[model samples]
Target chain A: MTLSVALGPDTQEGTRTGTAEATDSLTAPDIPWNLVIWNDPVNLMSYVSYVFQSYFGYSESKANKLMMEVHRKGRSIVAHGSKEQVERHAVAMHGFGLWATVEKASGGPGGNSGKSGGPGQGKGKRG
Target chain B: MLQPEERAGQDPLAALIGLDMDVAEPTDRAVKRLLPNVVKDDGAASLEFRQLTERSLRETKIGALRAAALDLDKDEIVLTPEGAKHWSMALNDVRLVLAERLDIRDEEDAEHVHLMQDWSQAEDVESYLALVYNFATWLQESLVQAMLQSLETRR
Candidate 1:
């Protein structure tokens, strides 16, 4: 699956902050945002799992695990880092018949958002 | 109640794979059970809305989660989180049986019939349908609400 895109300055900041030794993140020092997938009714759990597998190329068990997380826990942070990059991810999820939103990673749960609400699909809290 | 196949005395496995009296009951029960939750209407949902979604849930492979390996029963299918989006789009639907087969007749129904016997109970249609009841696009939209609350947990 092509990850949702949420490209922005914050994502760059995060990359820079995380890996001083790494060029990819250090050169792009923005706080990474997250692409969160919330539970929904229309798509089947398996179908959602398939999108993660087929679209994202996640292994079958990994895909099912994510889908199960969404089902059992109500939501799962499928991807993290970079507002602009996460936003792109959000769009891709929407196209595939999944419910997705992008937000700045929270300092707490997601560990990817720079703050509680950064910038992307919605600036609200992670569900 | 539809007669429990007065003809299935031959193959127990075939009989098991085929829809039985057990299957027929849930068609009525599934629609009755899920319609209120899904449509939330006093008036009955249109036949078209009920039929299509029912068929879609039963027959469509769950492309997202890869759990379509479960052969769903009437009670097994309900609107998916995304398919629920069509509810408003299909407001014209008035009354639906929510059965897999379009025809009430047995032969056509038999073609679409899948045996619950081969399925995994943990991921059966019943559980999947339950998830469908809990799922909604609005649930996704409402994550903002959940986000705020989880933030409360942290603080």
Candidate 2:
């Protein structure tokens, strides 16, 4: 499913700025989207880690770290790549019943610049 | 909770529906986990969202669970795309409820569940719930794999 949501004008502008910032990064400019999973009361910590490992093929320790980050910080950027790839990850996470979203790799409101904010901040959306 | 022979019988679907009904009834822990507040800081908006969506969401899940149970009773257990989605969500709901009831909060708790030997050796409520939790997890994992396989074929 192509999950789309309408954003306010200001939010849209912010997303553009964030996308630009992501593109300007030195290490890699092609990967400008992130797949983020948010913390929720329903999913178990271990289960989340297991999903990360099984789906993404991350090492156990790395999956555990990402799961812990989501648990402690309310969200974690699980993957970063092009829009299509990130959306695929988001959809897979949703298939596992995780609250996931694809957002531009830029910062979001509430002082959550691209690096810190949870998944849906750029679009203020969900999948 | 089901034996190998029993799993092949029609009773499995009935048992699954029974379990779904039990889960659908209001229980404090289940309710909190299944219909968690989306907006944490705003009490008013949270309450409003729950009131508006909770009932429908619960009903949808229940319906899906029941449908999946019926589907399992068929000769082939084939799942349509919509059935796949519903079954996945229903299986997740079951896991979430089982996890909450079992107090599976973190890695240690989940590891303890994994360490359990057998349901026949279950000495207490926690042990019994651990078995259920593990079974639900297995079920969900299998369904997820099946869904992924189908996605791969479509691609």
Candidate 3:
């Protein structure tokens, strides 16, 4: 699939003093964000795999592998890209009724090391 | 319930949601697919999720499908913003169910249906299910596109 790689608007420039500046040199763009799909009781496995294939243009085996990862691991990083792209992917996943979220790639800025909530975070209907 | 002739006046969403019980209650494979486990490897959590949300999810899907089946007799379907959202969700639910029944796991499974020469030669159940699966996929894709278009216009 064609990925849109425009520079993300919400790039946070990390500022540090002394030794801290030497260690934390990761740029916002370098710290990729992930679009995650959480396991849900409603969506079918095949359907989830199909979405991964159709939306991301993943090969059938890759899509199936990712679907299985979500099924087994409770969540999977379905895409890695700029925050804007990741957020867009999350929205599309939500449009398909899958539980989705966007988060700073593990060990990114703000030290928020886990999946952060996106627009459609809750377990309910789309607004 | 309206007679076949009176269905033109009936709400399209209602008509879709009011599918005969037999049509709604698909085989075990479809049922398992429609209601998949949320917490894998944790039987208790999976059961809990099912206990808490299965009925409500089913009810919500049925409600949305009913709302989407609004004006079946009309040649063109024009949905309000709210109707479009409901239609999208309902169509996804229908496609999920149909895909499961057809045993469509990957591109290969989908290709089998696409490559069929004639449904007349297939078993009655297989042919009927293939038709339903294809129809549901078309409807779901159309609704998703419409919803995306609506989103673009609002932005």
Candidate 4:
């Protein structure tokens, strides 16, 4: 029912006949994919943030924010997108020596995604 | 605190969330060779050994604690059979290693080994060396325990 906005021919707004399957396969179901990083003992907190900084090119504050989420909340979803994007982030985290994994996001989890919502607001459910 | 259980074919923490604490393994040759000597039944010996073991886990100061990892699976950390044995035996390892290094009199020190009151005086260089050894042991034990606990949590 909702129209997908497109800037050019590549988007083919109305000519959706051929690409429906492609799009459906590309995007996981209603559930969003997430990259989750678990806390570990060997690596230092600062070091984890530093790796996030160096690998993602995120600023120190941003990296620390994600790292804090992981430390305080037990785990945090560092990235989200299609399955491949989440997988890439998971791999990068592992290469950096942080514990990470991927899983399908739950529907209506009744919590903030940690962006607009504060802590205890968008709590990622423990499974 | 108890070590979190690690389930088969899953991340140790999540699957084994409620299982019994699985002990870690021993890696040092000396620790293995010397475990039997630890006075397992003595309350003071367990306390002294635990203090050093916890300390070792916190800090990698002990040469042997650094080397004595059971094994690491995925992200969950657990002690192996050998590791648990090592942990259980470490008290003896500490006693003997420090006893030899400190030149502690077999008779006098043996009777006083796990007693804090005995070392309060620090009457000789040997006693001082015992204190140092105790410190290193504490660092290693603390780190291992801390690592095991944190990793077992979902974090």
Listed per model in order, the count of residue pairs whose N, CA or C atoms clash below 3 Å is: 69, 3, 9, 37
- The better-scoring model by lDDT among 2 and 4 is 2
Q: Rank the candidates by TM-score, best first.
A: 2, 3, 1, 4
* Each model's Cα RMSD: 20.4, 13.8, 13.1, 21.1
Candidate 3 deviant stretches above 4 angstroms: A1-75, A78-127, B1-27, B73-76, B117-123
DockQ of 1: 0.02
Which residue segments of model 4 deviate by more than 4 Å?
Answer: A1-31, A107-127, B1-155
Reference interface contacts recovered per candidate: 0.00, 0.09, 0.09, 0.00
Chain B alone vs. reference chain B, TM-score for every model: 0.20, 0.73, 0.68, 0.30
Give the candidates in order of DockQ, highest first: 3, 2, 1, 4
Docking class of 1: incorrect
C-alpha lDDT of residue A99 in model 2? 70
Interface RMSD of 4: 23.2
Tell me the TM-score of each prediction against the true structure.
0.33, 0.54, 0.49, 0.31
lDDT of 1 by residue, A39-122 (tens): 632334434654675556665555666676676566777765665566555545644446565544553353443434432333
Residue-wise C-alpha lDDT for candidate 3, range A1-127, written one tens digit per residue:
1001121111112321255532353233454566667764334454565577567876555566767667666777777776557655654564456766555565323333435455333234211
Model 2, runs deviating above 4 Å = A1-37, A40-74, A77-127, B1-27
- Which residue pairs in candidate 3 collide? B11-B70, B12-B69, B12-B70, B13-B66, B13-B67, B13-B68, B13-B69, B13-B70, B14-B66
Candidate 2 per-residue lDDT over residues A21-51, each given as its tens digit:
4344423545567677777644645456547
- Model 2, C-alpha of A70: deviation from truth (Å): 3.6
> How large is the interface RMSD of each prediction?
17.2, 11.0, 9.5, 23.2
Q: What TM value does chain A in model 1 reach?
A: 0.61
